[model samples]
Target: MIKETFSKNTRINKKVCLTTDFVIAGGGLAGVCAAITAARAGTKVILVQDRPVLGGNASSEVRIWALGATSHMGNNNRWSREGGVIDEIMLENLKTNKDGNPLYFDAILLDKVSAEQNITLLLNTAAYQVNKSLDTKIDSIDAFCSQNSTHYTISAPLFCDATGDGLVGFNAGASFRIGAESREEFGELLASEDESNQILGHTLFFYSKKVDHAVTYKAPSFAYSHEEIGANPRSKNIHGHDSGVKFWWVEYGGIRDTIYETEEIKWELWKIVYGIWDYIKNSGQFEDVDNLTLEWVGTVPGKRESRRFNGEYMLKQQDVVEQTNFYDAISFGGWAIDIHPSEGIYSEKPACSQFHSKGVYQIPYRCFVSKDIDNLYFAGRNISATHMAYGSTRVMITCAHGGQAVGEAAAMCKDLSVSPKDLLEKELIHQLQQRLNRFGHGIPGVALDKSANKVSFANIFASSELVLKNYESCGDYVSLAQSAAQLIPLKKGNAPIVSINIIAERDTEIVCQLRTSEKPENYTPDIINKTISLPVHAGKQTIEFDFTDVDVIDQYGFVCFLANQYIQLEISTQLVSGTMSVFNKVHKAVSNSGRQEAPANSGIEEFEFWTPERRPKGQNLAVSFDPPLPAFSKDNVVNGHLRPWLNSNAWVSDYADTQPTLKITWQEKVELSEITLFFDTDYDHALETVLMQHPESEMPYCVKSYRIRTAEGKLLADVNNNYQTVNTLTLDSSITSQELIIELDHPSSDVPAALFEIQVR
Candidate 1:
């Protein structure tokens, strides 16, 4: 506005130089989680993102829904949601935007990052250059923001490359692989026969809405014709009702270079999308799409695979498929080994080939540390893994979960003045896991350290504990169109005597099997301990199946009822915590076919899939247990576990206990500066980040109202409408109390009050 100045040589845009303890390049869910986790652990963090908004693919620009272990509840990993910062983010999104608007999710991420005082968020800044002080250590990162025309030079002792494409790691000359490795390379059964350049491609999504008036569309000249697309055998799936992520198969560029030809891939996707829309509008294939209009289309394609940087250890196919327990385990993943066709949408092959392990597998910390760059860490889809293993670890939420592990390692490294590799020492790794678990991060087979909690020394008691009894049938009957099973927790001994109400169309002999997982931690019903046949009458009647003679271990017993459409099982409204009913059903979206049909010699086992039904219909099957199963003990709160695993690792009060109370008494008056309470938010629920809508804003199992008090009944804190899994109460000052009391209210009339863990510091 004042004057225009011309430079004789070159004009330098606004330049900024900042220093932090940790620098994270990328603002995707992984980077966001890393930044948030590091910052929360008292580390200065700088987060750089090329996009104007955070949440990369999960942002509105791309609109890919966030998913992790739950895998749309299509697999056998029950209560397997990734914990830590990502869980908090997902829970927050569920509370405020259960409808899963991408914009709302974007805001939530931005809000969370911005709230962190120690985080310096640089949006629209792309990291293009890496400055190294040594051959094995990154010194600084050079990034530029096109929107502001500014350059940022950020230096940090630690750096996390979560850019998805491994931009920072690539520029830093970190060891990486660009394509699939041969089966012999890692001895992977799922790997290709030989090394190949072909990889998963980029995908774009579009959102359409129904309008009041009829809408017309004209296809662009570049758009493919209906006939051109019809040449593909899968074209029949194109429907007006299906848009956005539902058209995940409308992809391309796997045959080409996804990194360099992003624009080309995007154009092809656009053409495919437009061609699909045109086919629905004018081809007379869809009957009711006149009022439908495209609301939004992604500008950039959501990338699936690219350069995977090598870490100290490259995760291989067997690690995931075998549920390998690494010595330095830091995180876990449960998504299937999902590999896509190299030809993408044009291919005759299925969109994706997926194979699931029996249970969730641990991800070691070494996979997050760079093998070449000492100061560099990997996150998101770029983390070290072979092509076959990457197929499972590449999901957004899973990447975010591993990001948390590296983030905490970064913080600990700074505190100890050591590199990430040094933390691999047995004691140090345990400490790191302890720190992660303290912040609500879940690691398979790892429990919170009891020595760190003052409550571990105290005696705990509760007003009442829930005893498995009877689920009052709500008059809801589900036709046994498919085999169904109720997962019941049992101790080592005889199985419980169970009775179920079934309505039979005609007199028939119903077969019931008592099954359990081969592994105690898994939910897969792979072992059948007993099979019983009960003759039932035509009308509604209760049938008793006694398994008191059947020996069992401390695991979940799958009480299975074979498929018989002639019979209908009674459903109950009693939605208890940790207990669920699953069906051998197909969820076509996640490639679940009721059973996995792996080819012989594929190294993958064929097993039946028992997945829970989504709510509004996934009520528990009504059943009664003789000599009620002794579970949900109050002492479970001090058991060091945070979520439901082999059992309901929670202190769940009886449904009849209106004002559930827990007491912690100390031998001597102890000083407590802080008290942390872990609640049940139903970790089993998959809170999809976008597109999909959830039935409830808050988890029905969460303790909505609670009060903390001293022995004298002096209120310390009164919390209401609580919806989060973790609630930390930092007292104004250290309180000296010999006895503490916690009063809880049931989240709903039907749901009981449950608390997973309690810690005093």
Candidate 2:
């Protein structure tokens, strides 16, 4: 047994040997993600949670959807690149639940940390005191648990305060600012003209759920009336469910006052919320939702503003709008300038429009480390930024990114035995970029110049690996079919030029052209390209002309090509018939077909087939299943134990039935790699098993052994095959030889048996 002593003033407890290299306070999205990231990088991490669970504001406690860089509620296009620990959590969530709702978010968070070998989670622990070295470096933190009234002293090389409230930073003697800044401070349009300590308000969200039966609820005694809220009619009566009412406009006081004191404000907001619901129910506005019942009422207020730590760098409003690319940027924010009134329940315009940035902007790593205290990093809304800037970066998604960056940086600091400020070196930044890239996090784009002999291209998007093709060229335009067009022009004086402007929505790619129209019969040595990869929003991009030596000019025309999605293209110049020729490499057909190859030797069976038993009528069901079969476990699998099993190539039988009728219900879902079918081929082959096999192209393929048996004492055909001779199966429905069968020789139950093997390809 371990004996511990406690100190009164500092709340220091008997030496509690810290097991983590970094202790991250506040289990909000930022803190949780940071812990996960650091732990994944082979760093021991301790994540302290004030609440019982993780995801502070966006958790079920506050009940808000986790938004991404895009404005859409569930939009994850931009976050695809923000993999690593965050991605692993999301992937796990997708595996268990497809809805992406709050019900499973906690599990996702827990699983992510719990699975990390180096992460220690201490929930219901709040950091209340700090011990620092003479030079103001964070030596240790004293966390207290209210339930047990026990204190824990945790010492770490690096510390991160992901607490949006900046609780740890405040206790550690770190300098921090709160409330709105003067216009002169950050030059933000929404900044208070006069220096004032006003800040954005907090909210307590309540949600309704639809049950099988009708139910109604009345307002609590603590609830207040609309008149008590004192907001304007427009402000108080905004649409709730439809417009997704966020009553942030109702706010009060700042860091100087305890937000707990504003219980009356929350009470008033609740009353207003219920009053609107009652009016809708009684006024007969919509009867369909009469069954709508209150599902949850957030206890932890969704705070939009809080203490801002003073760090090496303070992100200003000008930095955000100017799209300033910081040398030490650790994260990016795309949220708009969203601020709520501080005095009244509502204001004329709670959110300002003038200071809003047009696109995603960078936030530096220095903003995460405290200026006064060494070995301390801050994340989330507590980062070193003026109140106006925090208003925009306070969104949960942006905070998640911040958390990921800090987590990585903190881990790096421990490994190097240095502070976060010192680890912000060029080489360290490169390592961070590499780690983030592996997990799909976005880094600043590296601009590439056009080469004389090669048309090399690079990804110019914020943090994506997508590269550009056919960026510079001049040529005569020719139409491919009717929708696609190309231009082939010879090198001119200094630079041969062909410019094309295309407009497209996010994720849409179109075909482009650069060909010699002079050779209408044979457009040899022509270069046909495709449009640059568009982002999540609609935008336009220009391709300039750079021709060094080639000389060929012909009719230049443009045509839109058939693509996965529809997009409009407009050309400033019309196509004209002409003839000019120079030396150039012929453009070959670019086949995205490379991404759609058939699973090597693998077959898919019963892929997403649904029946009345699997899914009944009038009931919505989400289901996912993976076939059970042993494959060459050694080399076939990538990361997990069931590697070779994933190599099985399974295809759904088209003739079998695509959709399930009354007797058979099936929904054609996404394509699968492979599937397996179990059946009794004959008395001798009682347990006939079909192994849908696919080659593991990314890794070398291998096979262990094959087993076949029956319930009784009978041995089925047990044949061990090598990975070298694995047969390939095509997905084409016309070919019925897709299924490979394992036949048992005898009629004994043991003879006709299930087959298993480890297959590597």
Candidate 3:
């Protein structure tokens, strides 16, 4: 039994000694992800969040939208997202908090921590005191809960400092750098010419909502009008129409110590917020929104940079631009080498400067592990990165991924009874990458394991699936046949044909004639199933066709497009990503050399892709299936590729199906306890932008209601109204079965049923 003493300040005077495998400080997305990852790997963890809620900057008090590999869609990151735990959290946000309500977001973060059995979350607790051993290891951490003034002494084998400001790192006397380094230090073109402490400043934001009645405002004494603020380019972009993220330029305190002068900076920012609202509401400059009222304003400032710990490697700008392939890579960052003016909102020039990379660059495992301290590991904004590199890696989602990598590394350390650096030295890094892949994380050059499913892995490249396939350009398309026809691979037989997607330009009806290739060599449509005419529209849209009206029985491969002029197909570029095409005789492709593949189908009408130089890759239609198995070109579900749609991706069931059921079977009986399901929550949608009100929920094809059963027809687990992108279901008792059936009774939205991966492990 533990004894406690009450103090006059309503604090517990007793010494609370607790032990855990991993102790994580900070409650932001990064810290949250670290705790979640370690706990999920079968370890006891104590997560300390300084604030009353989780999600540090993303919390209700400081509402900065999370950004990462996608770079808020501004960096041209075609289908990239921070995979693994961050993907799970983001998808959950897309499903429930479509409006990006900070309050609901706070709940989501809290619920995730609470749902995990091994995580003991300490909200409103600050880890202020640290005890370091003489051997340069973190022995224990002391945290103070201000609400009750209770002190906790937590001892753990490993400590993760995810505190965005690196509080624990500083407290533990870790080697860290303060601000920008000279260009000579790293050879970064964008690096400051001289050594300086000019770091990215803290920012504050406010939300505005229009009320039914006219709303009025009373400006504070320090409020400054737009004209008075003068010469700030960010002012032009600031309007009632803009969301909070747009006001990231409302920042200050870069010249001062970020940790020491935070309060002073926040006070100045408060005046800016009220002043900006006064300009928008009181000043007659902008039109409309006379009834607009300030919904909420942040009291605490959202910090950008502070003390970055020194590790084995300090990532530089060239590494990102050149797409450096680090051997010890644990994660990848696609966000550009972004930099901001030190003067923040007051700067006369542009607020930010962004430079994109040809592709995502790797984040090495050495960056997070301490160079000197054996047990001290840190992630998030404080991880080892040059100031220029930190600009891109500091986004919340990227930090979250970093946290996950650090947490997983910590768990591995606990298991091996070795330090993080020693584990890497032991050449156990591949195990980490494999585990990251298994968790659905996309580490470039790392592929998902296909041996578990035993099914042959076949599909298009990663760049095939368009991120946002909407009423807009539903990704790119390529005419595989050039007589204006295309082919889609059929994954399995006896699977009823539900519908096929065709492209059109105008609101005219066109006939979609389906025909199976004869002799497995003729690429031309040999057996015509049925000619169904459907009305087509401008931009890319789907045209549905059913096979029940036709007579051909066995299995047929490929579908040809037949329409008058005006419709065009979209496909990926050939110079970078190569695609394969099927033609009747002489094959034509998107190529400069007029390159053609050996004729597989001979003696038929002309078949050509036209451009031989173009890779002819990821160029396919969004088709649907009944008794749905998987599409041939894009086998999102069955195929082992389980990251975002950046790679040719996704398994969609089309608009015709209301509820879809999936059945998984193996060659032999296997013990089954856990079932993981990754849903299609529409990666094409954007979330980190300055939202106008709360936007509509992302159109996700999630299984709203589901049930799991065994081969013996016994109900293993039944879940109704499921809303998770990564749905994990466990049975009461371990069952040995060769087959498992999943019935998706309802969908979260009006979209098709899609699954990234249904990992049996």
Candidate 4:
């Protein structure tokens, strides 16, 4: 290498210019997903990030666990995991890093983006300037990498602002708001009477290790003393077991300007973190922590609230609580309106206030497009939403879901020669939704477009379909300390009589209720159909709940058993594809109570939360129907719907069928080029990105091995050790066949084989 001597007055770094179809700023989950989606859709993409790694807040640097609609599986939104690219990332992470190592997650993201040949990733680069082709269109972006000492000029027709701070939009002169809107302005019941500048604060996390011997810790001069930390009521929540995201309340700087004073905010957070550690180590309030040593602390704070760019539509409080549907809906969110106090750790108020909707709500396409900037798109926490809605949409995986929508929209826009706004005025919005649903992005009320698929018009039949009959008791008994319910799919007419085995510690009267959701699509048990009381003795007995008089339409029936601490319910180890068990219990982490209480005029409905238990524990109650429910059918595999919503939308094989197979026939020979299979990956699981360990690496119901062949038994493709939900196979050459058959290996002896929609083209 040769050293250059600069004699001029000024010297600049090396400059590089690149042109692409789409440019994305920020390398957070949102940007990574957008870049990957666009790249897969045949668009040349240039993705830029200021950090050394891909994940932004979820990186090893920040270490915040990524959660979305499932909300750590602590609410009533059943089977509501953000799908598409984010779902893939989650499943991949589970396979290799179920322990939730942040560094491994970083590598997974890098691998996903790098695998896409159409994407050019720029690391340690920050977009600092925007060149506008018109008043509302961005021509190019100027970014610089401090590590390489080089400047890059990236030009593109479409630009997406995935930067958590809305950096690109800000540089392009986009309109944005920083604080809560007035209640009167948007008619939001959750908003304050008047507008306020107060916002949620930034938080930092620190990890600890329990060594074999005693470890001593000394506080720096900047660290606050125990007496100083004791001034806040939240300090009492600290314990010896507290670590990682469990200490999410170590926050500050919400009352000040979060953008301009970021450094100051970080410093204050540092002082609080060190002070909290000191208090834990030396205050003598915590026991058995003498062997605990601080392993690492975050260098940067994870920001919660920032500049929210204005879009064509601003999602308000009612849009979430009321579960409003939009004609231009593109994505969905189900997390509660989780707002933290402005005072943060120093506040006398509780750590957070969360209000959940009865079901998942849809987010419109207008929320992802800028109002004034024609070619600008918004993703991540900076999307168009009021303070109340932002509280739910700010989560990382939800942001990534929206990013996939934006990426597909950009690809479509490039093909159609139109702007993002054009999708709203035209019928193209339906096309966009269809594209998203086809790619495993689950929209609540939307179904896949089967007009072009050959399987939609063909005759589909399976070897055998599962008929609901019985889930025998596995001898695993759980105490009825809390109310529990079994969510079962039933046909229209008289509800089936369910028999549940229970052991009573003392004589008690058990109250059982049959219920269903007011909205047929939702899982919330708001409408009570029948109430029955069963008097039991001190011994084990099988109680029958006969709901013959309760008339019900096609929907989910909740067989609820109210809390009776003296009784223990028998549970079955067998996991049905379309069935689950939920409990009316409290999850303090997400601020969920057994029953939600709202003010008279708050407009938020009050309902009991019956959420599922995480796997290895959430066993369905052992129950048998007098007459088996006709829920699963062979035709469901070709039905358009991929995931469970109003119906199971999946064809499950009978338990006795060892070698399950599905056959599709056509009247005449048809040429097939591509075939896609959708398997059940248990969308109900939350799959948190970090700090939470999953019970299993692969979903129990997923098909591990499968084969595809023609009527003559000519093997076309054979796959073994498969774990993903969507598997697409392309023939080496077009093959003409009148009949196609798919054979699958059951994931486990107990868990039956299940398949969702299948597509043939």
**Candidates' TM-scores?**
0.99, 0.58, 0.74, 0.99
lDDT for residue 720 in candidate 2, whole number 0-100: 45
Report the Cα RMSD per candidate: 1.1, 18.9, 11.6, 1.2
The whole-model lDDT of each prediction reads 0.90, 0.49, 0.67, 0.90
Task: Give the better candidate number (1 or 2) by lDDT.
Answer: 1
lDDT of 1 at 508: 88
Candidate 4 per-residue C-alpha lDDT over 564-635 given as tens digits, one digit per residue, 9 for 90 to 100: 999999999888787899998998877888888886787788998898988889899998887887788888
lDDT at residue 333 of model 4 (Cα atoms): 94
lDDT of 1 by residue, 503-613 (tens): 999998888999999988999999999999988889989899989999888778899999998999998998777889999999887789998999667788788899999
Global lDDT for candidate 1?
0.90
lDDT winner among the candidates? 1
What is the lDDT for 174 in model 4? 98
Full candidate order by lDDT, most accurate first: 1, 4, 3, 2
The TM-score of candidate 3 is 0.74
Q: How far is candidate 1 from the true structure (C-alpha RMSD, Å)?
A: 1.1
Name model 4 segments beyond 4 Å from true: 1-3
